[model samples]
Target chain A: MSQVPPEADLATQDLPSDERAMLERLRAGDAAAFEQLVRDHGGRMLSVTRRFLGSEEDAQDAVQEAFLSAFKALDRFEGQSRLGTWLHRIAVNAALMKLRTRKSRPAEHSGDELLPKFLDDGHQATPASEWRDGGLAALEKAETKELVRRSIDALPESYRIVLLLRDIEERDTDETAKLLGMTSNAVKTRLHRARQALRALLDPHLRGGL
Target chain B: MLSCRELVEFLMDYCDGELPPEQREYFEKHLACCPPCVAYMKTYQQAICLGKSACKDEEQKPPKMPEELVRAIMAARQAK
Candidate 1:
């Protein structure tokens, strides 16, 4: 599947020498350099924030906040990774914090509450022989794409976040682990479980054809 | 010898090319001898293909960077 290459490359390539020099100038109170930095990273930041927050207003606010936060912390910029990755980290944090606040408000589970019951019994333990019976059939149907999308979106936030970062965003496992504060092994384990859950969700549709 | 269940557990890692080389070799041997495992692999490969096709639409469309919004952001930064 063709994906829009991550916007993170913008700062990775475009800035560097210029950005570091500009940042040095900003340290000396160069407001114009700071403005250039903002113009360079702002839209990409907004896009990443929007993917996580799912609201245009929230995304815009998050991007602004991320820039403000980045500016205040500019002295601490370690340059361990690309500026885009650094800024994206801030954007992701802001978006997640926003999501957490939204989750704090009482909300219905939307039937997702019942899924753990099925999962708890090790329904995931079903043998491959049994899985073969119908799993392929479900996948072949035209609506399978929509089903897969909804299934992914339905995953618990923790699993969904890891899957998106590790799989969809194509972040390296170690990078994802660092981003999530997890060990690489833990990331792999969660990713494996997440894929299993997705497979289970698709099974009913695929089973008939198998 | 890995049980069918154990093989199934490793199948996803296999598909992702995440399996360690030694373990991958072990699974390849198992696949060579096990018809069920081969079929299982086929099913998984198909699932991945379908999933990729499905997810492409979600990921490919570049997010719209509205001219007004970009202008507003640029303007705000300029005024800062």
Candidate 2:
């Protein structure tokens, strides 16, 4: 006899009644339901697109594209994931597409500058200093928040995008890889390098803030 | 003992708790004798935490999605 994992069995069940009803309404071309869906998920979707696209015009365009893509693809939605999760993925893909189509500028290539330096013997060239006692609590200050935001923005585009997808969006390696059209190993390598660079960038301020 | 350079390379895996058991043991043993690596690891983790916190603030106060954008999206869909 085959033994189904409990979680897998749960996944195969229908989405909750309200969500199911909403899906049906959407399928039936209910305009109000569609409006509700956009209003409900639009803000987060916009935020995500803005981070990836940077330009206000591009972000708005990406959000519009994402919602439209989601609407057209409603019939393909499976019950395995929440509608919001599914929508989020579409939004990320929409942003990526916009990024692809954008006019190419010279690659910034700043990742090496921001990455930690090591001695020939494989030790950090610069010793790390202890940060101030506050840790994340210091983010309460708007100034500190802005500093962190700017540091992240300073990373090279490729590394920044990976950092945003992996660290900020909280996407898993496989999903991130699939979205970025990279291998899982490539995703991990980029993620690691991004973190190391970010750490180096933040060190001076975080350390002095103490 | 893992060299500080090797430890730096493994920082992500060690922090993610993805390091194999034997490797993790070696990583920690190095940390025990290495103040600089410990400090590096701490700040590395703090950088991630600060980033997530800062970004969460941005999401919590998302830039308002223009109403016109919504109308535009609906219009585009209808036109299609």
Candidate 3:
């Protein structure tokens, strides 16, 4: 019944002693270790928060909150989880906390409109376009990456967060459902639709290449 | 074999490996014969990949970790 995603644990054993070293120092309340932890992990944590919060200021605040919380909880830390993984989980929670407090924006366009329409006869109403062949490798271009980011931002917050947590953050389905107070089935549906809607948003830009 | 629409309904569950054996067989069988559906699934999978990579720090913004944050947290760490 362990719902922790496998990716959440990462590979602590393979990581050189630098992480273990840091963990020990920080657990001892060594100030420099704490600072170094923030410095090393802060960029990634901020990126995680920004994906959820959108606003730069809120993202930074959330990262800071997560780090401070992690610092306070140090003695409870076991060696089983990677320092990065534990910090990543704390950062996700911090971002979600920020998300909970912020006033939600006005609802965007209908997600239903973004899904592929099927005919009454149970066939796709439209033909699939030929996407550039490299799959996501096509997104390696900086310009395309920006487009992907903009397309995600265009999604309504409700579905977008589900996509972020389940696919990007790689939380298990049950965990995501619990986080959003929905059932696992509901999480799966929303995650699918969120991916669909995001695909719709990207379709226009991809013209020949999503 | 499942129809295209039936397969569409199964797509998420299929990808999640949630489809039970008989249904899973039928789902794969449908994809086996249906090239359009095959293309659709590939694009869908790619979109997920795109979504996952969209927000990495390397993709957006400078690498600068905040200095103010470091100072604030360090001060708090020392105060404890």
Candidate 4:
């Protein structure tokens, strides 16, 4: 989750000297500075987009667009936060814009099937089983990491985006709501449900039953 | 004691520490005796931790940036 604070302290004067110099160079239209910016941040930006957009091609396009957008807005950057932080927000928005424009992938899971079921008496239909402590550490393995990513990608678009914004990107509820054009309540509900569904999807693997 | 269904329903609030004191007390009272709900809460928390760690791993071992992407963005910036 993003440890970047919800409110970035916009005291440009407090920016580190190196970042300040980079901002100045960017604002001065130094070609090398712009290229350097891309080289420095592009990989991380692409990673952010790749999660939002599972397609490599789309992720590349979104990162490309994000860099261009950032370049165009260079004058507006107040140096309040680290340049990387600003770029992260821009990258996320670019990916979301791409998500809005594209058609949904075939065979996406609506995530409803994975949600926990309850009986008429307000009890779990199936009692929850405990996975051994530290069982989830399997996610560090290459195959398990892929499984985790695939599980996230399997979620429905709306819920997936909410999950990405809230959990992965660590955007606040109000900001995520604004970004998705939904109410905070809606974001919270979707985030909670998304977590539940994702938990169900990973249960077998976590339980070593996969 | 809160039923398992009600506990699950407000699970997010409880975990987030957003539930009011009374409701949270009831929620905990239920968890104190219900082994299943305790397991459910632990797994649910672990799921969130796994998701964040999985994504954060990308930063530790970032995917290779395609050279073409760098070229394209630079070209676009030059055009602008």
Candidate 5:
């Protein structure tokens, strides 16, 4: 397993009772408590934002924007969900907005021109022969990673957004569906298809004989 | 016997623990007697493992929060 940093692991831990109490106080109009909440959840929010936006600069801006938005909407927070969940909702929206803005600008090369050509066959398995030659293993892995990223990026915007929010970010299905304004079944179907598409992209790189 | 496509779809939901108990019982019963589905399940599991390994290095790292940005946020909050 890849080693996650202790601080990052700590960020995922349940909030201490003291912190939760502070958050409740913040909900009751304590400015200091609000600041503490920012200090606690800011890193994790930025981490998630970076995953969505694919750039550090954009992630920072998104985190800042998300924090501001969260502060403004504090009154509306129902206190049913965890504070982290609420902040994450804000961060995802901020990141998606950034993506939309970037999309509006014409790209130097259209995505159609850069997409890989692959045959569609329900029965075809990835060739085991390609995984041989240990010397090329590293290069193959890099290519596979790029292929998976491209495959994900190729999904329809709605599908891609839901996949990122639900799978990569580890949001519960109900919360994800609510955030995307989708039914839970719709979210599940899209997620299943998204994983299938990703698997198809990766099939050619598997070493084990299929 | 479930076709390859149906098996794969069921396995997708199964692996995620999303299948309802009744549906899960049906799939498990089918898996008990079907050689091809069992083989297919192993391949699918391996494929997911390989996929994760292949992309593990590419996992995105969180960006460092700039001191200035943090300070700015703090300042903005104070002003508000």
Candidate 6:
């Protein structure tokens, strides 16, 4: 048997009864239940969509589309998962669809430039410098956060999307793979390269922040 | 006996604790002597911290969900 990843437990951890009731109410066509669903889940859904689409208008539209789709398929909801998780999946799907339909997607390119370089003999060509004492400690500063956000936004779309799904969302590799329609190995590879690129982007600023 | 380049490849797995026992020992041994690698690892961890912190934006008042969005969703359901 394949050993389950620890994060798999997170998926099934909190199958709360309240979400079950919410799902029931939603399926029964209770307007209040519908309103509650929107009011309760809308903010987080918008946040998820925003990370993917990066535009307020696009994110709002994606969340609206997700809620509509979820409402239409209420009868198909099996009460097995929390209503929020199901809706979260729908929202991510909607966001990806929005991304797909955009008229001007960012052009594709290899991220090899951002990855570390090694000499033919396997030594680093240019060794990474140690950040000045506790230089990285300033990462939580609002200015640093803003820089981090921009660095992430600067990545190529495919790598950025995987990084957001896996790292920012803290999603399991399997869920990310399923959402992005790639093998788990592919997701891991993209995530690794994304992290490497992001580190390279942030290094100088973090060192300067020291 | 992992080279610096080889050890860099093991980083994600090393942080994930997915490396086998022998390989993990070798990775650590390499780390003990390599300041650059140790710094590389710290920055790597910092990268993950920054990435996860991006999600904290959701916990705040997150630019109010569009006022028309719920109404639109309700209308869509009614039409369906």
TM-score for chain B of all predictions:
0.60, 0.79, 0.70, 0.88, 0.61, 0.81
| Residues B1-80, model 5: lDDT tens digits | 44444556667689888789988887887778666556556544543444444333443332345667677677777777
| Candidate-wise lDDT, in order | 0.63, 0.83, 0.77, 0.84, 0.60, 0.78
**What would you estimate as the lDDT of candidate 3?**
0.77
> For each prediction, how big is the interface RMSD?
6.1, 1.8, 2.6, 1.4, 6.2, 2.2
Residue A12 lDDT, candidate 3, scale 0-100: 40
| Interface DockQ of each model | 0.26, 0.69, 0.53, 0.75, 0.21, 0.60
Quality class of the docking in candidate 2, CAPRI style = medium
Model 6, span A131-187: residue lDDT tens:
655444676567776788788878878888999888876789998898777999999
Candidate 5 lDDT, A1-210, residue by residue in tens: 101101222231266577567667876878677667776777777766765766678878888878877777765555555677667767877887777566443332322322222225423232222333321244355555555556555555555566677666667889778766679888887776655554444445444422
Calculate each model's fnat, 2 decimals.
0.18, 0.81, 0.60, 0.78, 0.13, 0.68
True contacts kept of 5: 0.13
Give the TM-score of each candidate.
0.56, 0.84, 0.83, 0.89, 0.56, 0.80
Task: Tell me how candidate 4 scores on lDDT.
Answer: 0.84
lDDT of 4 by residue, B1-80 (tens): 78999999999999999999999999999999988899899999988887888888877777777898899998988887
Predicted structure with the largest DockQ when compared to the true one: 4
Give, for candidate 2 chain B, the lowest lDDT window spanning 10 residues: B58-67
Evaluated at residue A122, the lDDT of candidate 2 is: 78
Q: Residues A17-81, candidate 1, lDDT per residue (tens digit)?
A: 87677668867767777667666777677767765665688888777767766766776665556
Greater TM-score among 5 and 6 belongs to: 6
Worst 10 residues of 6 chain A by lDDT: A1-10
* CA RMSD of all predictions: 7.8, 5.1, 4.1, 3.5, 8.7, 5.1
Candidate 3: tens digits of C-alpha lDDT, residues B1-80:
57787887778889878889999999889888888788778778777887777666353453578788778767766676
Clashing pairs in 2: A122-B5, A132-A210
A1-210 in candidate 3: lDDT tens per residue? Answer: 211223333344554588878877876767778778888888777777887888888888888788878876766666457777778788888888888887776766767888888888777888666476645666878788888878887787888899999888888999898888899889988988998888778766664764
- Writing each residue's lDDT as its tens digit, candidate 4 over A47-88 gives 999888889999999998888878777766776778998898
